[model samples]
Target: MKKLQFLSSLGFFLFGFLLFSNLKAQNSTSSSLYFPPLGEETWEKMPVNQTGWNQGKLGEFLAWMENTNTRALLILKDGKIVVEEYRGNRLTGLGPMNEGSIWYWASAGKTLTATLMGMAEEEKLLKRKDRTEKYLGKGWTSMSPKQEKAIRLIHHLTMTTGLNDQGVDLDDTDPSSLTFLAKPGTRWSYHNASYTLLKNVLESASGQSFETYFKEKIGDPIGMGGFWQRTGKNHVFYSNARSMARFGLLLLAQGQWDGNQIVTSDYIREMTSSSQGLNPSYGFLTWLNGKSSFKLPAIQREFEGPIVPSAPKDMYQAMGRNGQFLMVIPSENLVIVRMGAHSDTSLIPYRLIRDMWDRFAPVIE
Candidate 1:
């Protein structure tokens, strides 16, 4: 009799647990916000912050780090700035930052280059299908037998020129800059030398320097103020949080500005889509945050997260050296930009997203 009673009690508890799980799944299924597909429209009204929402740990993070040296955090939904905060010291703490402060994009600038390549193609200045040597010519052809075959623009953009890590130490003009370590597009490696070579390719093909082409075309039209400034002898670019936000906005809009269609629709489609076989999650000059499962190189392991798995399967990102990140989630109609000389320089955005997403993602009607 006692065994029968025990079985009955156990059955009741199991039933309740299953019932609760079903209810939770139903709530999650009913959630309107989901992972975004490439080029899917997600433009939403600005200021996702609502009267009542759970910011969770994010509120505590901001409250504690008020005086820190983080540069700027700008969050926009449907093109209106929702969260704009500046902390820490500036260049001598002189001018206040608006949308005018220019931050060196580092490798994040690669996306700009990729987008320009697409624009140039649309204007007939360059063609993706054209062999790289069509312009670079015989001088560059003296590379290794394998290198000669591998010298395409696609190889440069994909970081698969098989150029070894030589440029990590080599100055731009070193003889090794022209060397190739593997056949083109067959390997997955990070080669700044291969990418730097692209500046030359664009110059030769477009008949304009990278700086000039972009300024005359995309930068000026978008109303973004930027300059490749010579800070001392080193040339770098700077723009404020708003400029970065606009850049993200252009991306999330799929290369359209005010319905003007800045970058061709086909190029935007390809930009967010993976090109090389090595990483299905990575696209041309862009890093994908979610997709079918794959292992990242050990260095990239730290930057990825279950965030991709749980957030959106179709999400992609543009990340820069030292953790500069531009995340465009079309499902959320969100373009988030974090620009900073992060205090530790580890490159993690840390609590900014932790707080913002938790606070703003509730989707209260």
Candidate 2:
């Protein structure tokens, strides 16, 4: 009798211990994603040593950034700022370019639109699979009705609209500029015209301006301060460095801000994960890392291997012209934002973040 009792006790104890360990891990993961309170400048901070980042190496990284005309670089780990560096203002056109200065997000704003589109989907304003003409009318594109019908809303989000990018003004909104390249979903091109058309589709579908909808859906909920300003043929978002980090945090949490789920987790997953087959290294307007292959802007070549090998495999980003970058790594509970003038000839921000990770891994290890 005592032996049986002992066996039963051992089984119960093992189950209890396993359950406790599981719960602890869950809590730890949750705790790693920090959400700052709304309407406040206050945000939690984690010490540099806690991240296992060597201070000496970190200083070297900052020196490199300063040498390269980096305006601001902020790194968030477990939802708190671990490293924040600000340098000279080489680009006077974009505000003061200081800590509180507002700078344009450029193409990085596309990620914001993607998030808004997901919210619109949640609200039943529109569907990703819905035909573009469903919202923009049949004649919105110069393509024939048959070709237009095949081009769904998702093509815009995925940059697979089969739109001709040859000799087309990227920011031009005229219907004639949207020339046909191939059938929808057959070809993938980083055509800004297709992406810009999304703004018109969102406005038409939601019965609100893109800015209004974004302010209501994402900006208000997350305590983010930014506005869409008319810049040539595009609407550019300008905000301080902290606001960009806030948005990155929201993405890192999979569209959850604090306790409120701003965008559905499912939509967030689809937005961050691969959206189409053409480019496995891209999500809904976001750049993904650790993919088997990737395609660059204005290039049809598919390079084999992760985009940024030095960064975390799970890292994805919103990159913009002039080196605006917002990198979100879910596995590490990290959100990194860089806003500044372009330091290199290439538009890709991979080198910047790769250099960051190379120096950062030692500290956090």
Candidate 3:
């Protein structure tokens, strides 16, 4: 908690202020404002009583996971439920959480987009090696003439898309931004804009909207029935806690369902494991905890920005605003999902993922 309070003290404004500054000038320039839709769904509250999942000190911490809003946590290890819990104002502090409770995926949905991309590859719809210009020609052209050249889908997937945060870095055309932070296969950055654009490329190549394609390829198979937010909505999906777990199970099982393979296990490994080495803390669109190619020194800078050493070293997560998270730890054979408003004050779901991992790790082994 000392470390967390310290992290809370870090400069979150620099990240927010920097991001907000760029949003204005780029507003008209963007294709749409629907990137992450905020439409409210009448949340379906399940009975909060979970038999196997009431963890120890972790339970008290989990009660905080949903601190002021709806929340649920599920743990599966060695194919058994270790912990499951949900608390929301809707529950009125009674009843128990069940298998059905829809929660927003937020940016965590980006992993689904990338998963669809891998499935498309298996079907040969598009190739990662294809130049970004080939599929997103008109849009990529409009992005910038400089960005049009030599940018590949693989580069976009790994977040080395020759672009920088328009909000933080005023100069998108700056020399360093123009150049890949590291070569295509060497680095990683959390580029929301670039990853969202991949949605278009997939649609263009597959003749299917992003959500429909995912349902056809993945949801139906895993029995998750997860539904996507409309086009331009980058990270909004609704599904039960079990649905979230199924997605995690698909990943935990390395992209298979019902003894049938949906995505190539080889590709799943690439997506979950480090695809690029620049930031050892990040995977394709997911977050990870691991060694870095170079010391990022977040603690040295006392940085609490997105990339830092506050999470599990072996953990990879699909995280979003308002405390929506799906954390998968392969070594523990674990899948943990936490969804809710952790705090109105904290923006990154810092405590949900960061603190939960620390508490969960000890009991896991």
Q: Order the candidates by TM-score, highest first.
A: 2, 1, 3
lDDT of 2 by residue, 1-365 (tens): 99999999999999999989965764456555788889898988998878776788777777767766678889998889888777765345644456677778989999999999888988888999899999988888788889878999988999998988888886787888887889888888988778888998999999999889989998889999989987898878999889999999888776677767788767877888987878899999999999999998889999998888877888899998878899888777888888887666465656766766777666555
Superposed model 1: Cα runs more than 4 Å off: 1-58, 64-69, 91-98, 166-173, 229-236, 293-311, 343-365
> Among these predicted structures, which one has the highest TM-score?
2
Instruction: Return the lDDT, model 1, position 95.
Output: 75
TM per candidate: 0.73, 0.89, 0.70
**Which 10 consecutive residues of model 2 have the lowest summed lDDT?**
89-98
Error of 1 at 90 (Å): 2.3
- Candidate 3, 183-216: lDDT as tens digits: 3444345555667777778888999887788878
**Model 3: residue 199 alpha-carbon error in angstroms:** 1.5
Compared with the true structure, the alpha-carbon lDDT of candidate 1 equals 0.61
Ranking by lDDT: 2, 3, 1
State each model's CA lDDT, in order: 0.61, 0.84, 0.62
By how many angstroms RMSD does model 3 differ from the true structure?
16.5
- lDDT per residue as tens, model 1, 1-365: 99999999999999999988965653342232222222322334344355232455446545543544457777665565556777654545667654456566656667777888888888888776666777666556337554575467777667666655543442242344566556777777655545555666788888988789878777776766566554432334566666666778777766767656678656876888877766666678777655554334324233334335434545567665454667787765667776665444533343443444454344321
